[model samples]
Structures are given as C-alpha cells and as structure tokens.
Target: MAIDLAPISLPATADAEQFKDFGREILGVNPGGMSEEQMKEVHDLLHKYSVLLFRDVDVTPEQQYNLTKSFDPSSENHGHGNDFSKTPGRKLFELNAIPGVPQVKLIGNGTVYNHEGLSEAVLKHPSHTTFHKTHVSAEDTAKGITRFQRWHMDAALYDLNPPRVTTLYAKVVPQGPHQTVRYDDGTGDELEVPLAATAFVSGKTMFDILSSENKSVAVRGRVKYSPHPYAWMATAHALSTGLGIVSEGLEMPDDELPLWDEDKIKVYPMTWKNPVTGELHFQVHPCGVRELFVDPLPAVASREGALYPDGAHLTNLMYKMQRPAIAPSLVYPLDWRENDLILFHNRGLLHSVVGELKKDQIRAFHQCNLAASDEPAGPTPEDVRKYA
Candidate 1:
C-alpha cells in the first residue's frame, strides 16, 4: 500500500502551479522572529523543496542567527567575524556564554568585507602555488566546462558530522551578463538571470534517476572520500567544488593531510532512505572521494566490510554523478539577487558555485551551518568517531 503521508499545509506561495517561483520564496515570513508553528512549516517545506530562497529582504546578522537557532537550537555557531554588535543585548560574544541563541557564523575575508585586505593576504597564501593549478585562468576561461562542479554534501570531507542546514545571506551579489539555467531536466522551466548562480541537485532526485542495476550498485557501493584538509578555504582546497570567494584562511597542518588510500579514507553509503521524508537520499562527496569501490561496502562500524566496487562499477557511478546528463534537469542554479537569503537543506542537495569570478568581481555571503547531524542518507563512515 502506498504510504499515506498527508501533505503538510503550505504557505500561500506553495500552490502547485506556483512552482515557477519555487526557488525564489517559500512564502515570506519575518526571519528575525519566528513562531514555533512557523518554524515547523519551514522545516517541512525545506524537505519538500531542496532550496528555499528569500530575496530582497532586510535582516541583521543576529536576527538571522536567532532564526536559524529556532530550527536547531542546539546548533553550535561556527560564526567567525568581527561584526560585534555593540548594543547591550544585541552584542554577540562567541567566547563564553549564551545558550539557546543560535550562533551566527560570520565567515569573512571575501571582497564583501575586505577585498583589499584579502587580495594581499591571498597573494601570500601558503597554497599560492597550489591554488593556481586548480584555477580556471583568464586565457582558458572561455573553454569547456568553465563552471564544472564535482558537487558535494556540505562539510562532507570533514571528520565531523556534516551540517543539516546551510543558510547563506547574500552580502554582495554581483551583476553581470545573464545566462539561462535549467531548473530541472528540460521538462520544467529555465531561469535566466545575471551574476554567478549556485547550482543544486537533489540526492533524492539523483537516486530516482538511477538504473536498477546502478541502483543496486549504489545501494551496495562504497566510496571513500579523502576531504582535503584545507577544505574550509575555497581557493586553497584541492578539489574543484569551489565555495565562491572565501578569504585566505588557515592552512592544514602537515599532519592533517588525507591519506591517499582506503585505510585512511572516510567511507559513505552511495544510497539510503531519508528518515525525515522517507525519500531515498545519497551521500556522495565526489570531490572528496579518493578511492571508488563497487559492490559490498565497508562494514558499518567495524562489523567487517562488504563488497567494494570494481573498476567498471566505479567508472559508471562517477560518470552518472559527474556528467549528470542522464538526469539533465537535476541542475537548478539559484539565480541570486542583491539580498537573497538562501536556506537550503545541504543533505538533500549537491551544490557548487557556478561561473568563474571575473578579475574585479567579489561575491560574498554571510553563511551558517546548523543542526550537525549524525544521520546519513545512506551509509555511515568507517571510523564513526570522525562524525557527530
């Protein structure tokens, strides 16, 4: 029998035909102050829609932090920045106190905050030479797959539990020549706009499109991701899943380098069912996967591993995810506006910064990762200690 999960009530903007504006807004409600019921609605809708964008809105960083806290109050704020609210109650002190209040991570260093400062700092970056190799140079810019994304589940590379939700508030959105991007396989509609758009594809969607043979491979497949230690800094990272313009930050200590072999690699399930929506989801960190194995996967927490992927299976799965041509419409690039606040489910979707940054362009956003979850859409890693 089909599971009868009565649909949750949606906001006024959630009408079926109104799906045209799905990426833009899920029905505007104040972010600064949210009611309990309102918060639940947001979570439901977030699961229903892969990404929820609120555009041209006014919100202070603290308010944004508070709002996200309402979703997952236990969420630790990795908020970094010098944006100290001086006002008595409004001031944010990351050092000592404050429980229940959501930690607003103020990730800085982009042009939005200190372009001149970052320019000089990045030049002296330790990875200066390495960062160059991965860069799409000016002469080679117009060539093939300029905006290629290996795609990732947020923080998938870290030995910690990946964030459940990621809220990025646009600090400075760029203006440029427009490009038309598909929302889903050509069956739906196309959005044309300017600046660099962030692309997202649902893991649930990816799972649905897999062939039965591939699905079996996915269900049984195991991938070991060796997340680059310098992953926090977008430019300095080894992989190509760029996170836009992040400031030159800390370097990975010599000891933190990921081992190239399966012994040191973090294993994750290729496919699993979502406990929240019961929708099938996957844990694919393409950029981080150092080794690919087919069939019997590593045992969940030392019970003895299962079949690993053969060369052919590994090749096929990577091609499906890397090419995504079979699921062409799965690509949905969020065309950003000046003040768009995007609250997206990082677990459900694979995101990548699309388009190359021009010489003088500096795009930055206030970002926060909330609700660290031990849950994986599919399988858990080999060493459970790395995750929450």
Candidate 2:
C-alpha cells in the first residue's frame, strides 16, 4: 500500500538544532477529515517520528474530537474524565470545555469572550513562578528570560488510562519577541524559544542515550503514581527546571487526598515499549511518581554495579536520569501559528509550556486527548534478559 503523503523533517527554527532528528511535518493535509488510508499513514508517521505537525489546518471542535478519537476508537471521553466540574483535579488544569463537544477543551492565555459558547472567560497561563521553588526574577523576565513551566506527559495518573495522543489546534497566537529559557539550576543552561512555545523532547532519544547499566535498571523498574496525582502535588514546589519536584516532602498526605481506591492506583513501567516500532522508551512523569519498584537481575546476569535491588525513591535520581534529555541542544520548541494543528504521540515524548503570556496578549486553542483503553506495554522477558 502506497501512502499519498510524505512527511518532511522538522524545519529549521530558533530553538531546533539540526542535529536532533525526531519530529516531522506533513504539508497540505486536512487533519479534520482524513481518509482511512491517510489516517494509517499519519498514525505510522506519528509512531516513527513521535510528533507530527500540520500547518494551515481548519478544524472545528467536533472535528478535532473525532480526529483525536480516530486514534483510539475505544476512547470516548476527555483524558482527565469528561465532567470537568466534578473531576477531583480539575483545578490543576485551566480548561473550559467547548460548549457542546465536551471532549475538546479551550486552552491558552488571556480572555476569550463568546468563543464556542464560552461567555467572557478569563484565562491564566501556566508559569514556573507559581510551581517552581525558585524562578527567574521579574528583572530577568523583563530582559526576555524565562523558565519551563513543567516537563510532563499529558495524563490523569489515576483511574483513567493515559491518552495515546494529544491534538492541539492553535486558533489565536500572540505575537511577541522570543524569550530565553534559563535553567536557574546553577548549570547556566539557556534556550532561545519563541514566545509562548510548546517545547518537546523525545523519549526514545532519552532511552538510547543511557548507559548499559542504567538501561538494565530502567527495564526492571516500575513507578507507582499517587492517586489523584495533580491534587496531591498541588501544594508541592517543583525544581527550578521543572523536570521534577523538590523532594522536601511537600506532597499532600495520603489521608488528606481525595477519596481514592487502592485498586484504581496506577503502577507503570519506567520504560514503555513503542507499539509500532517495538523500541523501549524511558517514560516517567517525575512529579506524579510516588514510589519506585525494581526486580533483581536475572540469576545468570552479573550484579556488579547495578541500581536499586530493593527499591528506589525520588531523591534527585529522576532528575539525574532525565535532565540530560532536555538539554537546550536537544529540545524542539514548536512556534505556534494560527490554524496550526499538532498531533503528538503522548506516550513517546515529554513536553512543556516554555514562556509566559501577558494579560493583554490573547491566545486561544482547542486541545483534546481521550483516555486510552489500555495501559502502556512494558519491556518483555526477552528484553529483561538482554539488558539484565
């Protein structure tokens, strides 16, 4: 079967370095209404590239919901549960549903009046200052310096399964000068990003760069996420770079969290296997992780210099492993334009909002992701044997 469309490597941009090769863009395709053949090609391209960009698209909220559902037919509601009003962690997300199509939510900064049935809504853009323990001062921000708001995969981390993909349609984009992202962690790292861009890093690249010993540990490790993770971390402060939390025990006490069932808690592998490529990816949402479990190496394998035979904790270990992957040289910040639709493999990458938006700089976008019907696939026994 020959697919009609061809995807090109991500174009050169201020934040994108030519050396990194993870994202692709398909030109001249209507994502809202794709034929079965086109959807297959797009799906395969997405798995292979991890992120797919569609420029100059015209899609409605209902169309966007249908397109997102096409990727996961069994999925029916929003990724965090459809009823935004009753969801426990709804406060964590600054979202407003698109009137009739509850699956698609309105996101972005500033006020949007009478939009898709929303009458006069005030939006607050996510910022590191509110979440990070330390951040760039107003003086630095005035000088066009900022920090990443958060580094995470879009998921509820509870009863519902993680979404397979997330669709974001930019309806209105604010125009402004580019800002420099400062990693205030004493490393002096910086990235020149477009104002209010979405930055992404590839999980496959993160796994491929790890040492052999770490790879073995990753394959054997499982992460237990806190129930209602967003609400649990609501009061916690993140690290300066937003890669992980400051482990000063700021997490909400288990008894104080919303009513939760033990059976509904999620425990996922540290390394998830890509369904189409069969490649292992080191995927973990550091902020939501509550506990780490690891199995001992195979009897035949050497345990010379291994990690965590008993168990592990979130004591800078996650930051040490994940920090390198988000280095400025490796990140790709997607510069948004009106009518630009991006379909990203939610399982294959970690992303973050890069800069802040002024109150007057209005930006409107429709975002949609449906809870997956199944959990992520983990490393196989053969994989454990090979690495262990």
Best by lDDT: 2
Off by over 4 Å in 2: 1-21, 309-316
lDDT tens digits by residue: candidate 1, 338-357? 67787877777677555544
Candidate 2 local lDDT, 22-129, one digit each (tens): 777787678888889989998988887888888888999999999999989989989888887777655666888898999999998888999989997788789998
- Give each model a TM-score: 0.63, 0.95
Candidate 2's displacement at residue 106, Å, is 0.3
Q: What is the C-alpha lDDT of each candidate?
A: 0.49, 0.85
Q: Report the backbone clash tally of model 1.
A: 13
